[model samples]
Target chain A: MARLLLLACQATANTVENEQKSMQVAAVDTSKVSTDAFLKNRLEIVRVDKKELPDGLLKVQVTARNVRTGFWTQLASWFMGDNPYQIAYRFTWLDIDGMEVETAASTWIPKTVIPGDTVRLNAVSPNPRCKDFTLSIRENDAARG
Target chain B: MNTKIISLIGITSTALLLTACGPSVKRIDATGNEGLVTVDEVDFKDWQIAAEKGINSLLASGVLNRSDGRKSILMISTVKNSTMQHINTRILTDKIRQALLRSGKVLTTTAVGGNGPDDMASKQVRRLEEDDMFNQSTVQKRGTAIAPDMSFSGEIVQQTSSQGRMRESYFFFHMALTDLATGLAVWEDNVEIAKQGKKPLMGW
Candidate 1:
């Protein structure tokens, strides 16, 4: 009977350990474009294109490229087990008169930028507010806070 | 005659006592169903967590407050369920809508595009007097009806991968807030929830 109880205790401990390990989130590089000071040092916003949406509103597409391949590439390599990873871009919109729209309609999102991949983000003008736009890119930390 | 009657009563009492002491009495205690351990694919606590997470994220992101001069009126658009199970995505979205309204950031209208028609019967009833006044030429025109300033639309996708008894199920919730006039998505959020479990053997 004592041996049986000891065996059960061992099994319970093993199960607890496995459960803890399984619940752990695989580490992914959480450096956001707006937050990472180090990456910003090496990467530069190369070109941005502005176009009129079908409603005659303007959309700005900003592309950023890394000047040095070392740090950014190394960070991407660290995100091995992160699945369904997404990169979100926040767009602050201004009216034709250059006033912020101040609505929930300002945030646009993009996902999954692998290593050495050029990421594209779209920022649309909310109707009458599409007179001008500014795009901010941030790397999403996996639901930490 | 008195002795015979007493004996008869005693015999009946003994028989009744024996009947009460039978195996059926033990069967009543033997049939136990409480505290049974079982495994389910989606537990009630999971839904509770998912609902709270979805609503909190949507609210905290300030998606509902983005109104352009207009009072942020929202219409529930479409919630596509891309899961193997026939899960009701509306249950999740409704909780989010209610939370948004409670936050005073936005209000949802039934009339706009959703899974069904908006409940306008109450609005219609209230408008009848105004309609009558307009018909009698007492008023020049009907009051301007408030239209939804934005539309809420999104999808729920689920992926399940398992190795033997160990199973991992992932659910992704994606939502977008779009401006009606420009058809541009202003706010978008995605939430991923995953659960892991080992298969139950035999009784469990």
Candidate 2:
């Protein structure tokens, strides 16, 4: 009986550890982040999908999950105005030759994500020559006030 | 002994006060949200959002494409400011121009504008053709300027309202592309940005 009880306790501890490991895995995928190493820890990019549109423009969609909660409450956020973990993302398009395809559409865009919420961000290349792209994301420091 | 201890405490307090009064400065990324919002005025982020939406929609519409497989010539028209806040309309137009130019589908003409001419130099150089002060051969000849195929113009308007303690402001950026020959609007888009918060201590 003593040995059986000890094994049961160990199984419960192992189950808790596995649950934490899964949560961490769901939080962020390190392999998918091709650029911006700084955001690897701060943000959780769950999925990235790209396709060529009928017009030859390349469309890219990124789904990101926020892993952190608001540091302040609603009333505190309203009064003192805290940065609600806002993110700014920009995409750089590259042609088949690996040269940068400059487009006016490539600008820093700001997005807000509630804690633990998954949000989809999409962008289309301005021209057909853009066959590849690099996405960069960073936390908005100004919003963190 | 007690007086000496009191003096030491006073000096420590003074040092702390001075340190607290020192100037503090921090640098932040311009593209990210620094959490700056004003109830009465439009902000840079607001402009970015508007420009992004307008450019994206314009590109997706393929209105700048020409049937002749040649780059379309574009002219800047009047962008009327109907908002209460003073704003240079170029903040929105320039973004569209830059995007269209980079796409290699459109070229903007400096010889034409709503006010008169985008660059008076194009017209001023013509006078040199008749003047002996300069070489007539090098001067721009008449009918050499390319006419714009399309004209770009827009309007920016704002609306404000309040209910209880919360106030809201909405800015609408409306843009249209008109075909010069047909005198028809080929493409049009509107971007709206709305903000709601408590009433500020100052201007609306």
Candidate 3:
């Protein structure tokens, strides 16, 4: 009986160690965004597409996937840390001259994502001068407070 | 004496530890999502999300730019608050107005409002025309005030439901821009936010 109990203990420890390793791998995968390092290693940009509207306004859509820590890692996080990450993003419009089109309309829109899920966020330019846009995504660490 | 000293030291350490763990407050960014959230109530972040979606949709529709070589004048109309909570509708409209003005395609007229003139100063300054204490040349003349070409109005509605230990709340923000001349709706948009979580330990 004692031997069996010892085996069970060892199995639990191995599960925890494996979970930690997977979390590390997920972190490393998040640092791939070259344009903005802040979002790197946090979110993976899967696709981006833009189109011009009939009124000459620009619309941009971005598909981003959250880095997944394994099931065991998520279980561990539920007990001791933040699990099921939340994030906020906004789009900054740019004119044809590459200068930012200033508009107070843009706000940080919040979204919640479970591990391994992809979320699509889209935005439209406030005026016809907007020819391009850059999306900014950051971890929604506000709830922790 | 040694026992008493040890007891005193222990009490001091315990007191310090408790103080460290006690609740404290700190400032946070207003425009950012750094505020507390309640499961059954609409929070600031929720308002921001709705406003962002509504303004973006309105701008993208390009209805405000339909005016011929001039910025469309907008008048603030009644925004109905149909929610259980006593929420001020200005929280949402103010954000939209700021964004619309920044776009330079629309201008809000302070000379007219659903309640009254948004800027009473327009009328107040006109009264100065008869006062010798004030310069008549600086006073706004009658008929010089521009009429609003369009009116902005909206409604915010909320619904709540509970299943077992979980509670869900949904808020819908609806807005419309009406052309005063044609008496037709020029643009309309709606934004909905839904949140589900464990029931609050305290009051709703």
Q: Candidate 1, residues A1-145: lDDT per residue as tens digits?
A: 7544432332110000011111123522332234354335334555666766443445556776544345655564344222223344456655545456653222224345544456555444444343555565543332111
- Chain B TM-scores, listed for every candidate in order, come to 0.65, 0.85, 0.88
* Each prediction's TM-score versus the true structure: 0.43, 0.71, 0.74
Compute the lDDT of residue A5 as modeled in candidate 2.
43
Q: Of models 2 and 3, which has the larger TM-score?
A: 3
| Candidate 3 residue pairs in clash (backbone atoms < 3 Å) | A30-A40, A30-A41, A31-A41
Candidate 3 chain A, run of 10 with poorest lDDT: A11-20
| lDDT of candidate model 1 versus the reference | 0.53
In model 1, the Cα lDDT at residue B104 comes to 55
**Best of the two (1, 2) by TM-score:** 2
> What range of 10 consecutive residues in model 2 chain A has the weakest lDDT sum?
A11-20
Docking class of 3: acceptable
Ranking by TM-score: 3, 2, 1
Scored against the native two-chain complex, candidate 3 gets a DockQ of 0.43
Chain A (alone) TM-scores for all candidate structures: 0.54, 0.64, 0.66
Interface RMSD of 2: 2.5
- Residue B3 shift from truth in candidate 1, angstroms: 20
* Global fold similarity of model 2 (TM-score): 0.71
**After TM-score superposition, what is the CA distance of residue B141 in candidate 2 from its true location, in Å?**
0.2
lDDT of 1 by residue, B2-112 (tens): 999999999999999999898752232111111222232433333434555455455545545543634488888888888777677766667666655554557778755
